[model samples]
Target: MILDLNQFVSKERPYWDELTAVLKKQEEQPDWKMSLPEARRFHYLYQRASSDLVKLKTFAGEVEVAQFLENLVARSYSRLHEKRGSTIPFRPVHWFLRVFPSTFRRHWIAFMISLFSFLIGGLFGAGVMKFAPQHKTSFIGSFSHLSGKPSDRVAKEEKKQFDGFERRNTFSAQLMANNIRVTILAMVVGVFFGIFTVFLLFYNGIILGVVVFDYIADGQGVFLTGWLLPHGSVEIPAIILGGQAGLIIAHAMFGWGTNLRLAQRFRRIRSDLLTIVGGAALMLVWAGLVESFLSQYHGPTVYPIKIAFGVLQLIALICFLLFAGRTRQPDSIHAG
Candidate 1:
């Protein structure tokens, strides 16, 4: 049952006010330290405010009350989670384990859109190659190296790139640079209303689909899979996450039919964008390393090993996003 706004606010206002005061004090005087009793009081007040916010969300026609609680709770949450010079420090690990996964969980819908966008583009490119072979060159121009079936020369070139430590290091650096450049471009371009971000993702997906389609159509599907999956398993997801981040930034600006003020929307996006971009960049680095070191070692004996490792990497990525930070402090603000 929904309580009357008057009654609910009358009951919860004290706690909310107390939390707001504590957060305000922290913001106004960053160097000020909270005593043991004050810290306990702040925690109690924050928990009460969080509980009231949940109740407010469940009831309709309480927009003003809900908005107040939302802002208050978010501010209080940020204050409590802020780094302190205590023995139990909590900034570095907090971002990866708490903020990143929470952001991922919150924006899953955007991620799905990103995934589908890429898949649709890839399928369209594949169709162009398969149905209208004349336009294949247009779609697969620079990536022609990956097309028209496999050859010994191509295999030897791949091996040569990874044959030595110096070459492998150089290749890894190049891979990271290229992937990070694409990821950053995808994310930053969203500021232009996200149109270019969409085009960039589609272009990347088209290239991938065209190459894969060519290999499969030429009866080199298995070899191509072995060569691609090791690094691509992580690389593709990283790119999709970058797109998700960009879409989020764009959505904040375009309103998406929300009633939030510009400041509110910007705050939400700012909180999430850092964690999303940071996580994606980390994944790209890992993908680059794997691509340079492990992806080029293809053979009857090595192929299954690489594929198995790739599967494990994908599983680990999924598990981290779904499960990490689940056991965080109860009062931590829910990301979104």
Candidate 2:
């Protein structure tokens, strides 16, 4: 029911003022704790203010009263319900499942550029090693000696990585450290206007290609597939994402579309980079574990298992990036 604007204000203003004072006290004195009776009174006042707001809207030309009620009710609701600062719960699982994938989807173009650069570079390198074997040393120096030799060198190098430590644990840790180092390097070099990031992607791709060709030349294709794909599937994508993060920063600084102020753009870019880089690091840790423990074990018995595992992992990763955090688009129908 409608009342005179003056009468409505006269009746409701006291409750509004009381609720406002209670909320304000909490704001002003951090150490001031509300007593149980006071909290119950505050909640009752909040309910009264909400009901008053609905009534005030019924009075035509009571704009000022409605606005005051709106503010009072909001502050009271916040005081009673919202958690602030350190009170908020931290859930890593929620962040990974929801926040990370959404961030990945937002900056997917950078990932594509990184992925294509590495893949094309690798394919080109492989073609060169196959057709122009004479120049294999020019591209891949250390691996050059392995060409046409037995696969013993590859096995020996694996052994060397785990020489001084327990096989699974320390080797996994070392592998993680090394992979993280490379990913960080890729990210750091993106500051060179992304020129260095591009170089890194191509370099990594080329090395992979050369190594694969070398293994093939020695008639160890299956062995290389089991060892490489298991970890490479995850590790390579993570490294590319790190590069993607850096390139995003480079783009914010120098590339096209400077509609935002420089500081504002950089702030937005920084937030996106944090999520991308963090997710990439997590992937690298998984890759390192697989590389050290699973990929290195390449006998006939475990060969098919490793290859299948790699395929499944790669598929799951792709699906996660593509579909996770995606909401169905609303229908475009509109009422006439």
Please give, for residues 223-320, the per-residue lDDT of candidate 2 as tens digits: 88888899989999999988888778778768576688768887777757778888889999999888887776656667799999988999999999
- Model 2: number of clashes? 0
Q: lDDT of candidate 2 vs native? A: 0.81
Instruction: Report how far residue 243 has shifted in candidate 2, in Å.
Output: 1.3
* lDDT score for residue 259 of model 1: 97
lDDT values of the candidates? 0.82, 0.81
Question: Alpha carbon lDDT of residue 240, candidate 1?
Answer: 90
Root mean square deviation (Cα) for candidate 1: 12.9
Writing each residue's lDDT as its tens digit, candidate 1 over 1-336 gives 767889878887888877877888888999989899998998888888888888778865588888898898898888888765654654877888887998898989878877888998899888877888677778767765654445553455556534465588889989998898898888888888788888888988888887778777777666677788889999999999999988887888798889999789978788688789888899899999999888877666677888788888889989999888776567767799
TM-score of each: 0.68, 0.68
- How good is model 1 by TM-score? 0.68
- Model 1 residue 43 lDDT score: 86
